[model samples]
Target chain A: MTEEPFRWLEAIANRRDYVQQQIGTGSPVFAVSLEAGILLLGVGSGQSKVFEIFDRQAMAALGHPADIERVRQMLIDAAHLEAFTRASADVNVRRLVSFGLSPQLKQSFEQIFQAPFMIDLLLGEVAEHPSKDVLVKVNFDGGFKIQHGGVMVAAPKPEQVTLATDWLKANLDQKLKPESAALVLLLAWNSLTSGTPLPEKSEQPVKLPDALVEQLSDKVVEAAVLERKGSNVARYVPLMPLLTG
Target chain B: MNTGIAGDFLGLLAQNNLRPLAAESSTRAPEQTHATTVFAFRFRDGVLVAGDRRATAGNVIVADDVNKIIEIDRHSLLAIAGVPAMAFEMARVMQVSFAYYRRSQLQPLSQEAKVRALARLLRENLPLTLQGVGVVAPVFATVEAQGDKVVPRIYFYDPLGAQFEAVAFAASGSGSGTVRSVLSFQERFGEVKPSTMTLNQAIRFAHNVLTVASEFDAATGGVDPLRTVWPVIKVLDANGVRDVEAAEHLDARKEGV
Candidate 1:
């Protein structure tokens, strides 16, 4: 009976490996903060990976479609509830992540008797200035990190996440328009999925990777932006036309 | 009780047992804050919605800076003319609910569905309304797209949640009796119908109507040039809702015919 705890730990580790294997080939989601607002981009075959969570917030995920939907619904409910109980302006990513989502995810993950969530989520919140933008990356195991306005990635392959994010950070311009930012994210996605290395140096004028652009024809790009300057209080706007056009 | 889904914010609030105010505290009659004088009319461009800047509590002027006209979404305006607390709560809930539905469902809630949603909220609030502590008669205005043509619609709701489509105009609150009569008179005999007037003339007519109402009903604070407070007017067209500027209010106040 004394070895029960050790055995349980081993089981937990096995579950981690199982989840990682299940999500290894899932599509990647990327986000970058720009002068207009924050843009979240994801490419997938059928289901949508990008969604608006609140007035100034949006989310993108890569994993099992059902699990991603569950998390997305949970986020939407939490945001609305927060906006209801308090005010809409007070509904932000930090509170939603730190107080609401992270704990729920951790509890679900620790409860080994049930299946852990098989998803990696990227949530972005726009602010008046690009430097003050907020981006949160929530992992399958409930681990998360908050970053100030820059670039972030939730790559399907765990090993390439840092490489992809670093490449984006070095290559992404803070002033890129919505369409251009989407193109940059798509190039990074192509690089990560095709196992090709991004250029070592930044290109003066960003260009679509000719070799990798064709693969995107079969995939639908899901994108949304939270515009900073708008008369309406609801700032989250979908950018499907920006790419599809 | 958790559905593990989104799109119904009010339902979620009920599940959480969250109310704008405690329901059990109705043991004694509390002094209710009442907002007065809100109306809407179809104009040449779209719909012109306006609300007075006064709230009263049993013959006592409680506040003069209250904003009773609320923007539920970009395309809809809600003007309330009853208990300020309950009316504002309803507006807040509708705003969030509309947004929640759009974000979760990935499509705008239909115009019919949006109007019905307000009716549902009033129906739910019947308990408080019967207690005489919460009563809200509100006017809703929106621009609905029909095929390629966008048309403006106005709806007014009773405290018991009965919704009626306002063809030319609708008014609510203590001063509405006078405002309604004047509107009917203008629509029937004036040089231009309220629905056919230009934007500038519409603004002038709104100011004139509110001014006439305040002259008879103390609850409606008309054009208080000394306090520099004018009625809040918003225009809802195919594009969206935009506030009439304070300068425009000055122009309307100065050029009233």
Candidate 2:
């Protein structure tokens, strides 16, 4: 956010520091603490945890009295407690959502996914066959549309693919600014044409492109996301880049 | 728009003493309530988002062909799973909120920032959360640049203002738990899927998990994918999120990422 760092090192540093700042001094559990959770910002090794939000005042005074002002400021701003209340009372805290969904979530998936215009969405839902559990037909009709923001690099088809992998492989890797890598990935992921199925289930999806494959997870494929009316045999087809991604 | 603000929003509401519900995780809902099935999965480069078309209030199906996937912007997409009316309103507000963020920041918020903002919004909606009427619990999956890797992350939220990172994948709404178990087994973690797998592979994954869940769990609906029109499936890869049609699965062997 500051000066939009161009070089990889500087950009990455900015990103890392910014994320750390955002992490701040909060509960390690990410729970909903009504009171302050002390942040042990010092780097914590596997043995010691770094950065936590503490709720005690007297203890904080005894532990690090020099940070009392900072702690008070945090208590006031984060805990929304009065200076006097934060300092005077010995506090005990509990998490509102230790084992359940956060109270902050309640909207549908559509609203949650589409918050970036500079982003692209690939629509890929296919159902119109029989349950492969009972049927013998491998009828597959896959359709997935791509919608993207203004084009920085257009790849309507494989010929037009400007994906980070494609771009970087097409002798542009050296020229690409790290800032544009995100855009390239966005473009490739939103490709309108079909290419290959994802690599989670098969070994081939991993070999298609180094840049793309490296980023993907090695999670095993479940038969949960797909549908086969009855045929155990699969009828493969090309739908969109998202499917092949 | 990414209701990253949902948490903060709910927290703000709760601070004001309003009741909010974690609709996505509401096990206490009336047995006869509209049920929506939603899920999110990380792809090679992007994230896939999907939902069913049926809304059942009890045994009666009130709506069919309800597309849960919505396009919020060019880069991001949203798939909703919750009370329909409440889901719609939350989606609407979230969309407006993105515009608000853009206006305030004078630039579109980063994808990561969007997630946090949506979390905050949900947190601020806490007042409404306690009264059994809450909205905004949805699984958000996206491919973000974490160093050189474009790692896809799936974040699941709770009405009480908490978040958990879902590894591999996550399913929400009425039939998540049962489906999650089934998916855990069905998910292909070891294979190179991007080039050799088919859309049906993903659908089969969804169908297999849903079928197993629906067969045993009363909450999860049975899978009719490929029966009627299969449920909409999208993939988020480096290419971005796109829908996968049945025909696309035909002869998809030759294509590569």
Candidate 1 wrong stretches, greater than 4 Å: A1-3, A200-205, A209-211, B1-6, B25-28, B253-256
Q: How is the predicted docking of candidate 1 categorized under the CAPRI scheme? A: medium
- TM-score of candidate 2 relative to the true fold: 0.42
- Taking all chains together, each candidate's TM-score versus the true structure is 0.94, 0.42
Best by DockQ: 1
- The per-residue C-alpha lDDT of model 1 at residue A133 equals 96
Taken in order, the candidates have interface RMSDs of 2.2, 17.1
Tens-digit lDDT track of model 2 for A1-245: 33444554465445435433433321111000011111111111122111112212111110122232232222222322221123212221212111111111111111223221111111111124211111010000111122111112222222342342333234223223222222233223423223442222212112235543343333111101121122311111111123114
Instruction: Give candidate 1's whole-model lDDT.
Output: 0.86
Question: Ten residues in a row with the worst lDDT in model 2 chain A?
Answer: A132-141
Candidate 2 Cα deviation (angstroms), residue A226 = 37
DockQ of 2: 0.01
Q: Candidate 2: which stretches are off by over 4 Å? A: A1-245, B1-33, B103-106, B146-149, B187-200, B217-221, B225-228, B249-257
- Each model's TM-score for chain A is 0.94, 0.16
